[model samples]
Target: MKRQIIDTIEQYETIIIHRHVRPDPDAYGSQMGLKALLEKNYPKKRIMAAGTHDVLLSYLAEPDCVAEEDYNGALVIVTDTANTDRIDGPYFDRGAFLLKIDHHPNEDPYGDERWVNTDASSCSEMIYTLFEEGQASSGWEMSAEAARFLFAGIVGDTGRFMFQSATEKTFEVASSLIKQNFDRTQLFADMYEVDRKILHLQGYIYQNFTIDENGAAYIKLTQEILKQFNVTVAETSDLVGSLGNVKGICAWIIFVEEDDQIRVRLRSKGPVINTLAMQYKGGGHPLASGASVYSWKEADEVIGKLQELCRNY
Candidate 1:
C-alpha cells in the first residue's frame, strides 16, 4: 500500500494534504510532515497543507492558503482524519483523487485509496514508515523539518511514549526522528508548558471530578467554569489526559460544552471506547476517541453507557 501511494504521488503535479478539524499534534504533524517530505523530493510539484491554522500549533507549522481552484486536478490526501465529516476543509472532495492515511479504526473509510493501520502509534509515525519505504524503493529523502513534525506527532499521540498504544516500532521511529537536526528540548517545552490559569483549572478538575464504583469517571467543563478560570475551550484539550493519573481508573470522559454542541473526549486504560464514540457520531482509536452530544441528557447517556463498558471490562 505504501508503494501504491508512492506511485500515486508520482502521477500528481499538485497535492493538497488535510487533517481533522480542531487540530492536534498528530494532525498537524502528519499533514505537514508529509508535505515537507513530498516537497523535498518533488520540488517541482505544488505540495500544500490545507486547514484552519490553530494558534496553539504555531510552534509546529502553518497551513497553506489553498483556494477553491487549487483542488482542480489536485491530489488530495487527508492524514489522521478517519471520517470525511471530520476533515477540516470543504475542498477535500473537490480534488481529482482522494487518499486516506490514518492510524484510527477504518470504520468510515472515505478515500478512493486508503492505508489505515490501527497498530500505528500515530499517523506521524506511519508517515515515517512511509518515508522508509520510499527511501529504499525510490531513493526518497527526509529533511530535518519533516522529522520534527513527525516526531512531535508521535510524542503527542503516544502521550510521550507513556500509552500502551506505543509499540516498539513507535520508539524506533521516535529515535530515528530525533537523530535529525531539531531542538527536541524546545519541542518538549512548547508541547507541555501550560498557563497558570489552566493549571488552576486542572486543580479544580482534580477536586470536582466524579468517579463511580465501576471506575468510570467524568468531568464537565461548562462555559461558566471556563469563564471562571479564564481559559478558552481550545486550552482544555491539554487537560484531557489529566484524569488518567487517578488510581483504579478504567475509563474517563471530559465533556467540554461548546456553543452548539458538547465535545466529548474519551480515554481508557482498558476497554474499547471507540465503539462508544461511534454511537455518538464520533470514532477514533480504541483507547482514545471523541464524540459530540447536543444536550445534557444525551451527555448523561454517554456517561451511563461508559459505566456499562467499565463494568463489563
Candidate 2:
C-alpha cells in the first residue's frame, strides 16, 4: 500500500493534503509533514495543505489557499481523519483520485485508495513509514521542516509518549526524526504551553469536578464558566487530560458547552469509552473518544452511561 501511494504521488503534478476538523497537532503534523516531504522530493509538483488556518497552531505551519479549481486534477490525500464527515476542507472529491491515509479504524472508509493502520500511533508515524519506503524505492529525501511536523504529531497523539499507544517502533521513529536538524526543545515548549486563562480554567475543573464511588468523574464547562475565565471552547481541550491525574479515577468525561450543543470528551484508564462516544454523536480511540450532546439532560445521560461502564469494569 505504501508503494501504491508512492506510485500515485509520482503520477500527479498537483496534490492537496487534508485532515480532520477541530484540528489537533496530529492533524496538522501529518498533513503538512507529508506536504513538506512531497515538496522536497518533487519540487516541481504543486503540494498544498488545505484547511482553515487554526490560530492556536500558529507555532506550526499554516494551511494554503486551495481554491476549487486547484482540485480539478489534484491527487487528494486525507490524513488522520477517520470518516468523510470529519474531513475539514471542501472539494476533496473534486480531484482526479482520492486517497485515505489514517491511523483510525476503517469504520467509514472512502477514497480510491486507502491505507488504514490502527496499530500505528498517529498518522504522522505512518507518514514516516511511507518516507522510509520512499527513501528506499523512490530516492525520496525528508527535510528538517517535515521532521518537525511529524515529530509533533507523534508526540501529540501519544501524549508525549505518556499514552499506551506509543510502542517500541514509535520510539524508533522519534529517534530517526530527531536526527534531522530541528529545534526539539522549542517544539516541546510550543506544544505543551497553555495560556494563563486556560490554566485558571484547569484549576477550576480540578476544584469542581464530580466523582463517583466507581471513580467515574465528570466536569461541565458551561458557557457561563467559559465567560468567567475568558476561555474559548477550543482552548478547553488542553484541560481534558487533567482528570487523568486525579487519584482513584478510572474514567473521566469533560463536557464543554459550545453555542448550541455540548462537546463531550471521554477518556479512560480501564473500560472502553469509544462505545460511549458513539452512543452520543462522536467516536475515536477506545481509551480516548469524543461526542456531542444537545442539552444538559443528554450530558447527564452520557455521565450515567460512563459510570455504568466504570462500575462494570
Candidate 3:
C-alpha cells in the first residue's frame, strides 16, 4: 500500500506516538525511533511518545503519556502494535487521526491509515523505509539517538539476527543504522547486560522444568517458588526459553503464575506454535506463541494440546 504517512503527518499540528503494552525492546525501539524522527523533521509540531514499561532497554527512551487535551488537532501514531486492544494509553479515541505501523505475522489494522508488513523483520525497519520514502529529514543529522533506538528495535525483534524472520533487508537496515555512527559496543552491552540476580533466578526456575510426551518442555513458576526467590513476576517468565535450549528439546513452554491466570509462552524450533496457541484463544507467530489459562487444570489441558501440536515438529 502506497499510503502517504507524511500526508497524515502534515494534517496534524501535534502527534502522539504509542506502542504495544508490556513493551519489549522492538516496540520501544520503533516507538522511540519514530518519535525522534518526528521531532527532528517536524520541529513545529508537538509529539508525545507513551507506552507501558516493564522490560529491557526500554528505559533508554522512557515514555511520557500525553494528556487527552494534547490530542486535539493531533494525529496518533501507533508503532509495533498489531491490535488496537494492545495499544498503550487511553487517549486513542481523543485524536483527530489515527495511524498504524507494525510488523507482525497477523495484521489487525487499527487506524484510519495503516501500514502493516509482516514480511519485514521489525517495525523499526519499516520506519526506516518510511523515512527514506517520505524524505523526512532527521533532526540530529541522522542522529546517534535515532540510530540507537532503531537498532535496538531491530535487534529485539530479530533476536539479535537469530530468528527465522531475519532477512537480507534486516541487515541492510542494520547497515544503514551503523552508518549513523552510534556507539556499537555500548549498545550491545546495554541491551544484553542481564542482572546477576536474574540469572540466579533463571537457574532456580530451570531446576523445576518438565518435558512432555512429545518433547514439549515446560516450567511452571509457583507462588511459593516466587516467594522463596523474592523476585519479581516477569523475571521467571524471561528465563523459560533457555530451558528449551537443552540439547534435544524441540519445543519449550513457560507457565507463569499471575493473579487470576497462568500466562503461557510457547516456543518451538520446528513447529508452528501459533497453531497450539490459537486453540487456547491465543496467537502469535508460528515459532513463538502465547496464551493464558484460568486454572491449573486448564494449564494441563493446554499442555496436552501442545503435545499434540509438537508431533509435527
Per-residue accuracy of model 2 over 1-313 as CA lDDT, tens digit each: 8998999999999999999998899999999999999999999999999998776688898999999999988999999999999999998999999999999999998999999999999999999999999999999998999999999999999989999999999999999999999999999988766445667888999999999999999999999999999777888877889999899999999999999999999999999999989988899999999999999999999999999999999
Per-residue C-alpha lDDT of model 1 across residues 113-136, encoded as one tens digit per residue: 999999999999999999999999
Tell me how candidate 1 scores on lDDT. 0.94
lDDT of 3 by residue, 33-86 (tens): 988877887789888897666644434678885887988878889889889889
Best by TM-score: 2
Better of 2 and 3 by TM-score: 2
Candidate 3 TM-score, C-alpha based:
0.67
Rank the models by TM-score, top first.
2, 1, 3
Residue runs of model 2 more than 4 Å from their true location after superposition: 195-199, 205-313
lDDT of 1 at 90: 85
Q: Which residue ranges in model 1 land beyond 4 Å of their true spot?
A: 194-197, 204-313
